[model samples]
Target: MDSSENYRVVCERVAAAARHAGHEVTLLAVGKTQPASALRQLAALGQRAFGENYVQEALAKQRELAGLGLEWHMIGPLQSNKAREVAARFHWLQSLDRTKLVAALDRHRPADAVPLQVLIQVNIDDEASKSGCRPADIGALAEAVRAAPRLTLRGLMTIPAPHPDPRRREAAFARMRVLFDDLRRAHAGVDTLSMGMSDDFEAAIAHGATLVRLGSALFGPRR
Candidate 1:
């Protein structure tokens, strides 16, 4: 299918999922490894929020699409050396897995720039290879992020380990929802639950994901 057609299908599915959940869910078009033109095509269809994994690649795309007025998000594992650039560029940081990284982002964020929206990525499935804070460490990290003058703690995010059983995926997403609710009760103004992706976003939504990151479904398998 063409880009426009692909985008339409994804949007429809997202909307349906949101309807099923009875909440508004944001579709974060994962643009990692995609070209500026692909972004422009999506942007033309009224897509504003885009997710990227690599800071350098995102920066290049941001520059290329400077005239488009899109909102970029850093959704991959971030490095200490790359914090400043991510702080200066992306509007949202969804992979905030450590307190030290939070401190770096807060310190380097330009005073004139808007406060960066943040989501504490929780290692829900506790995979050793994943880049997210353990579920037990969320409170401390959330507090640290809340104290950061330049960061706005939006909510929690997680990339659950893929499972063959649909019920297992649902269970993980439901667990994330519970954590998200608990976080909201403990912290004021906490709202977003950035979980889900192309494969299991429907399940994520069914269990209460406010944001779903999509790549292949919208952009046709990344190059």
Candidate 2:
């Protein structure tokens, strides 16, 4: 399918999934390596939120597409050194996992801007290579974010180990749902549970994901 056709199909599938789950699910088009023109096309089609994994690339896109009034999400693991740029520029940060990052982001966030929205990325499967914090440490991280004057705690995000079996994937999503609920109960503004991706977003929604990040599924394979 071409980009327009792909967008239509993905929107249809997302609507169907949301209906099945009996909740509204927001879509964050993962525009990581795609050019600004592609994003402009989608923006014309009514997609305003875009997710980017790399800071520099996202920043460039933001500059080029500044007139479009797009909402940017930092969906990759963020290094402490890059916090200021992300804290000032992106609309959301979906990979926050440590207290030190919270402090850095808060301090660097522009005084004129509103509190930066953030989610705690949980390494649910405990993969050593991943950037998220362990499941057990969510409470502390949540507290730290809450204490930061420039950040707003917006619940959890997880990239579950890609188990080929649907049941195993569902199990991981279920665990994330429980964790999301626990976090919501403890924090007042914890609303977004950003789990799911191209292959597993439906399962993520069924198990309680308010937002899904899609890259190849929406834009075809990266160049």
Candidate 3:
């Protein structure tokens, strides 16, 4: 299938999954390594929100397609040195896992621009190599984000330990849902739970993912 066909099929599947999960969900097209032309194709299909892992690459795309009015999201591990760039460039940052980065964003976000929407990435399974904070650190980080003047703490995001069993995947997503609910209780209007990706999005949706970040499932394998 071509990019458009892939996107159409992915959307249909996502709707089915969301219906099963009994909730509305946002589709964040993960366009990390894909080119701007690929993004333009998805944009033609009305896929407005795109997620990118790297700041410089996303910046280039943002410039190339400035006329399309796309909403860009930073969905990768962020460094303190790049916090300012991330704050200024993306509409949403889905990998906020620390307090120092939170402070840096708050200090550097453009005063004229809208507050940068943010998500607290939780390393749900506590993988040593993952970029998210541990479940124990979420509340503190969420609280800090809530207090940051230029950052809006939207909700929680997670990259669970990959598993072959659908039940195991659903279990991880279920844990994220519980944490999401707890976050919403403490912060008003905390709506986005960005969990899941190309491989396990359906399972993530089945467990109540408000946002599923997909790449190959939507754009096909990168060339």
lDDT of 1 by residue, 95-214 (tens): 999998988999989999999999999999989999999888999999999999999999999998889898988898989989999999999999999988888999899999999999
* Candidate models: Cα lDDT each: 0.93, 0.93, 0.90
**What TM-score, computed on C-alpha atoms, does each candidate reach?**
0.98, 0.98, 0.97
Worst 10 residues of 1 by lDDT: 161-170
Backbone-clash count (model 1): 0
Clashing pairs in 1: none
Residue pairs clashing, model 3: none
Q: Tell me the lDDT of candidate 2.
A: 0.93
Off by over 4 Å in 1: none
* Clashing pairs counted in every model: 0, 0, 0
lDDT of candidate 2 over 2-92, digit per residue (tens): 8888899999999999999999999999998899898898898899999999999999999999988889999998998899999999989
RMSD of 2: 0.8
Better-scoring candidate (lDDT), 2 or 3: 2
Backbone clash pairs in model 3 (N, Cα, C under 3 Å; residues 3+ apart or in different chains), count: 0
lDDT of 2 at 95: 96
